[model samples]
Target: MRALGPLALAVLVMLPRLTSAQFGLLDDGLTVQTGREVHGRWASVLHLIPETGRFFPAYWLTYSVIWSVVGTRPLAFFVVNAAVLASLLAMLAHLVRLAGDTRVAVTIAAVAFALSGPAVESFYTLSKAEPLQLAWIALSLLCTATAAARARGSLGRAGWTAGAGVALLFAHATKETSVVLAPIALGWLVIERRAKPGHPCAARFAASYLGVAIVSAAAFAVLRWRYAALPLGEGWYTRAYAFDAATVGPALFRIMAWLVRDFAFLLPLVAVGLVRDRTRGPLLYASIWMLGWLAVYLPWPATFEYYLLPFTLGAAWVAGIVVGDLWRDRAVTPLAWPTLTACALLWVSAGINAAADARVQLVVDRANGQLVDVLGGLPRDSRVALNMSPINEYHFELPMHLVEMKRRPDIAFVRPTTAPGHQGETFLVTPEMANPPRPTVRIALHEAAVRQDRAMLDGLIASGAAERVYETTQRVGILEFGIGRLLCRVAVAPILDPTYCPTERGLIERRTFTYGWQVHRLVHARPIAATMRHGG
Candidate 1:
């Protein structure tokens, strides 16, 4: 257990080094210009304006304040993240001690937490508040459980348990996902009630939990009032798909595959968790918590592997309890040292693999730095469209700053023919532009001249209507194309063979939608001609 202090210290030291890594970048860094006009240190800038009702203002405020002082530098971000994770681990260690054998239980849980590779992405790279949130949840659970264990004629202890409920509510408000902990809170109340007949502490527990719930609800309502008439739950993203039993098969497989890829070292804990279905005391409580969380989250769209943090903590606690019990009972004698040695070896290997993976991601982030430079250099108002994934994936943090400054970029980079009827006119290629009733122009560029395979940018240039501005590594070339000098010669030029189409239609499809988005070449082909004939 003493070793945890040094191990934690080392983790704290390594955290700052990672801040400069890709994972260290956060939305708070980019919100510098409009950080105050929007809202001070709240995530007000992250969402579209008319924003309201994001839970746990405290969480974002803390992060934003730190980010404001630190700037967007990665190292600074890493330091904060490291501190949060270290605190979380220390809390978990304390919880393990409260539950069972200090050494074995704490050691196994620590090994599992440290060995799990995906946690590296969740805790280190993302720099999300989830680590801190989980720490609070663990601490709350520990406090409440400790109180329950001592619930022998003490209303004050129940009041202490109520404080734990308040903390849990704070955790949930920080992230909607922490709502899973509510079941545990309710379960604790039920267990306490059953154990004590007409227990005065029951009343205190109910009042405290109810008080926390009311306060949490009020906080949510206030947040919603800032955004819209409707509750925050009415948002579209919440309606996205999650997982159910039918979907669970695939989700389960996915979780397993991810574990194999990133968490090969923690296979023992996973195996133990699965094999030992029936545990007693808090171990049982931890097991139920894990299963309950999986059931609740498995079917929701929130199944991003990082959502497994709470479950991972619960499982680690359970593993620690089970192993520690074995060590104490002498049922697992003689082989204890051997088992611990093997786990230690796996722990060392896991750390090495995690570090290596982080290094690879660091290199990839560096390579992508070129894209960031190009995107940043573009006119703030001119949209630099992306064709592959949503631009938000790459520029999630950067764009919030742009939007908050009321500098909405006009350029929307999207694939043509993405919509069914709104083709050709809105998208660039087709005969509609060839003899357009109104003036339009075609822009052309060599595919290789773009220097990088940015198809969205290349396609925009190739359409011939855009004035060409080509740049090599060192120099930029600007070609002027005014309306009078340019000819609107939109013709059907195929970009892709239709054999790739899922519908199997045999036709060469030119991409759709024109530059200004004023024309969908095929759909408005007739209307545009009428306007041109009238000279309107």
Candidate 2:
């Protein structure tokens, strides 16, 4: 049982790879632009607070640090986020042990968190505030627990407990959802103190944490009042689906079904933990942790599955407590079937998630890689015209900066409609122009930019300036198409006309929408398009 703890950790470090796909454009692209182009410093990043209505100073600072060290390499950022995941697991494991669970329970719980499907986005995305806040909240608990159970003197205990308060402040700095963490941690402390009844050190420890929570709360309220003025409890994304008010009730019901489907695997363990022992056990802490976050998610409009990552800590502890309870109970003998069943269920759910990842994870990665190779191979001092959507820019640009920007082999990259006074031995980079309506021509997308892009591509082809050197079709994965359909059913998502592109299907990843990707490069340009100037 003792050795099980280390083995579970070994598995956790490897399990995160299960959800790895290259970063999407919105978060990853914005993050990359910060480092490679848009001043990556904290001063430049903070300007976004008023515009975006989000105050994520800590999240930006982490990226600035990554940019300072790795210089825009996505892999380096991934490694750092993986370390955050590990720290998160370490804190959860410590919490479970403090709750009096056996090593077997801690081991199972740690492994479950590493493989959680609903928590994948936090692990996979380059920019997210959710994971950071969870780590901060857990660190607070670790500090408080260490102070209460191990520190001997009042001064020593308060010193250790002060660290917990700092952790809570960090959590509030990271995400809006963190408003729930303080009450959960503080409530559990108060409950524990009630059970013990007037130990001087316990009273001191609880008072310190409560004071920290209050200070953090008052500071956070100021930040919220100044910024984050968006009121989104009415399920704002539902407006995108274009549902009638009369039909909204059923649509919301379907969304609830989807959320339940995504969360079903962990639900049972959390339920059992709450029901089994909420009086003075680990179950009580787990209940507060789970219920607290559930309250926040209820009003917040973003119902995406990845948003559930904040609940991973509570879910993990609940699994450990409930399973540990079953493991220690000798009354249900026969080699502990209940404990074995719970473990099997966790693995089975993980298997299902892994299968789903395999189906859709590689689509963007394949296209992004091809785009890099095409751009990387361009001759030095040559001018190239490139046109694609902003989301595609994210998929294509991060690697461009990391792998190609340093070299670009001295080649010039530009939009299809080159500006005045720009002339060179130029080539046009395009995607499946032979097939229309191209993504650039979609009305829902920016109209003026796409029209200029379309005219340039056509003029180049008609003038015989474009000589096709490399071409490949990138199709949207079946799973991506299915997710779009699910979104449509959950709320009457607009059906994009086939006139927009060859494929009727579309998908949204972190609010960056895409139809599909296809790469077609025209080499040995005659400079006619580059020399020609078009007015906007």
Candidate 3:
């Protein structure tokens, strides 16, 4: 406990930096855009738009406050995200302490939760509501535990119970998925009170919690119905999975595999803690909290890694309790070596995951920053037709860039139309343009895009429709972990052209990851030219 505060603080400082490496906003661009629009305007903030789905007032409110302070600075959002993560970790520590675990166990669990791979992704992205939802869920759990310990009919018990309900409401307001927590909490209460038949305090507390949950859920539903109209059809992203006979088997397999991979490191610790601890209440509660979320998300067609943020926290807590128990045991048992070995392996796994994440973050940050610069240079009113790959580094569409760059609303920035005879005075932006007009307009292209579409580039050059205007190369030295001199030497090869590799082949080959915004202008001949040629 004494060292817990410092450890948490250290993690708090480190989390934002790790997640903030990417330059542009990720998926949460819409929320930020809406928040900016509705800041200080209460009426608009309360109404949920059809595009964003259910009302997430808490998410909107937090967005308003943070955007108000930081404006468009990406680092500011990262800092705020880190702060939320810190608060979540603090609440988790408190929950573990309430569960009667030793200080050693509490610290281990909190650290593990902080280091969770899925949690790292969630916090790193900074745009999702999962982090905020997790924070509120932790607060709700702590409040529920506090209420369970208090005397029936006492003011303290009532206050804690009320607080728990409020926290649950905030959680629901943060994310619709939080409704699952209510039943899990109720089940926990039932299990805890089963031994004491006719226990008035237990029964009263359970009833009060249930009542609050039901009222909260009903009120939210009514508000959503009255204010937020559901979309007639779910988006392609959401409909990527649905309750289909064909997909159910695969979805189940994926869900099972994900659970196993993510929690394998923590399961042993949880098992040991459950066996050694006198009270199984905390372990059971955490397990149910995790399982409840799994049951809800697994059936849904569109569950991603970030969706598992809450589940990761529960597993961490369980592991922490077990580790703490092992530390407290005075006897040297046959299992001691095995347990120590597993813990060591878990730490190694966490380190490797963090390193890999860091590498990708570095690459994405470099790429997006360059892309923003290129797009920013274009005329504000240019009718830019973007032909970006569907699965780019950031998984962004036009909306993300428009929101981040604060482009003029009147500007016609759109995806390239597939329709024939779609000719106009447009600035064509693509990774590799085939059959571009002679003396092709040159623009910076992302190296990854160019490499992936190398054949297209070759075709354009061979047809004399494309020619390099000028090559601009940048060296990202930070990407070079070691053996820098060799990498720099290899960067000079012509096989790695300047469009994709502006610098030495070794240093710039794979190390260089950016969007190449190759600018091209379509050439259209006058109608009179065709008539004169036919007459001649």
Candidate 4:
């Protein structure tokens, strides 16, 4: 009986993932497999090191094991991600049902969440930790509820409470954002207890869970402070000293855009239902859940859009309630216009998600394979340096490393020998890196060094030390991207790189997203004296 509902949700939610290519990205995306563990050896998953300002031991361990055991290109990463995503959806629906919502409400909740902006972004990276983290967090809540209602200060009660704590710890280990759930879990236990009046209150279980949460929180705080207070990926993540005021504006923009784009049609119905929102228990729960996430996320330094996955879950629950209230009554409602409008908006959101899921396939993955072919054609022991585009965000190095590891072991991919003494060196430069936008940002970071690097690059190419051996360019311009936007509205990532997308710009200004490149080599073996002119 329960099988068909979950199965249907699985297929509905995973349709985009199933169709999109599942290769990993260079940074925190699926394929970031360089030095996954301490000294390339498998450390325990409980390794307390706060790597890159985040305590994701489970995340690191899981990826490390998969990459090491299966070699660099494990296609099965997609299969595992699909299963996790399906499980997440099933658990979400079950939780809604447990909250005393109707079956229609449960279906609505699962569908909205599965097609949300966070869902699209999280599941796009095969086996990304966000979806898995959410799954564990939900399970932990379920365990807490079980202990609160069913256990009466017995060993079984202790067991259930401990299970909840352990499950929550797993969530925190997966992604530190899950730490926010600890407080929510403690209070949620009270609500669960109140639901069963005849059963004595599980105060002892709650106290045990509280102790666990307190110890866990202190441990994470100490580890993070001792290790991660240093520099991590970008400044706002760890170096900004917990937070700065400037981060919140762009963060809110990204969050609101995601909410509106995903559930614009449903917002009206939510507003319409707001009068009764004071009385409805589920609505209150959902709203508080969303507020809890906001309380943590808005003030915190990490501003990535996918961090809003928890917030999106809360919003989806609220959406489910609104839809459930108005599913049948046209006389009462809200979508000959309400239902029809939500379906239309949902279609657009789904399209956006599908497009995001398919994004890497269009450029990076294809570049990886083509680049492999290009490197394979080079002579044995050819000295090559990669001069990537400064503006190019994707990690193109992984594929190059894979080439050296798997295919052309003799081709030495080295740091650019721009210091002037290295001979017979081939510089593989992707011209798209030289391209810059209108510089709409009023204040940009690190202006001097970046200009110097670009200028030196231009000087080397102009001096005629070497010529381009081969090149393949993929046509990617503004019009095709515009068509994509017209098809499905975009949910912008909350990245602060002014060079890529300026926050102040009025969204959608481009003749080209990027001109994709498979670069050729420039063999330059000359003194470095000729490459110092500095002009843009």
Top candidate by lDDT: 3
Per-residue lDDT over 296-335 for candidate 3, one digit per residue giving the tens place of the 0 to 100 score = 7754653455777888888878777767766666366566
For model 1, the local distance difference test gives 0.46
Give the TM-score of each candidate: 0.60, 0.67, 0.76, 0.74
Per-model RMSD to reference: 14.6, 8.2, 10.3, 6.5
Q: Pick the candidate with the highest TM-score.
A: 3
The better candidate by lDDT, 1 or 3, is: 3
- For TM-score, candidate 1 versus 2, the one ahead is 2
Model 4 spans with C-alpha error above 4 angstroms: 4-22, 28-41, 44-53, 185-237, 277-279, 299-302, 328-350, 353-357, 360-362, 376-378, 389-400, 403-425, 431-466, 469-515, 527-536
lDDT of 2 by residue, 1-536 (tens): 44454345534553544344354444565666666543434555444434445665666666666777876566667677777777777777887777667887787678667666545545655577777888887788778767876556678677767788778877887776677766765876777666745455445545566667777767877765665444223234322333344344433433343334343455555555555543135666566777677655554332444566766667667766776776776366443465457656645644344334432334444455465556567666656565534334442454444343345646665545433454444555543322221211111124344555556567666766465666654543222112323334334322222222223444322122222333334543333444434311
**TM-score ranking from best to worst?**
3, 4, 2, 1
TM-score of 3: 0.76
Error of 3 at 528 (Å): 22
* Number of the candidate with higher TM-score, 1 or 4: 4
Note the residue pairs that clash in candidate 4. Answer: 335-338, 335-339, 389-433, 478-511, 478-512
Candidate 4 lDDT by residue in tens digits, 120-218: 666655546777777777787667667766646678667877787777777767777666665764664565466544224344434555566666666
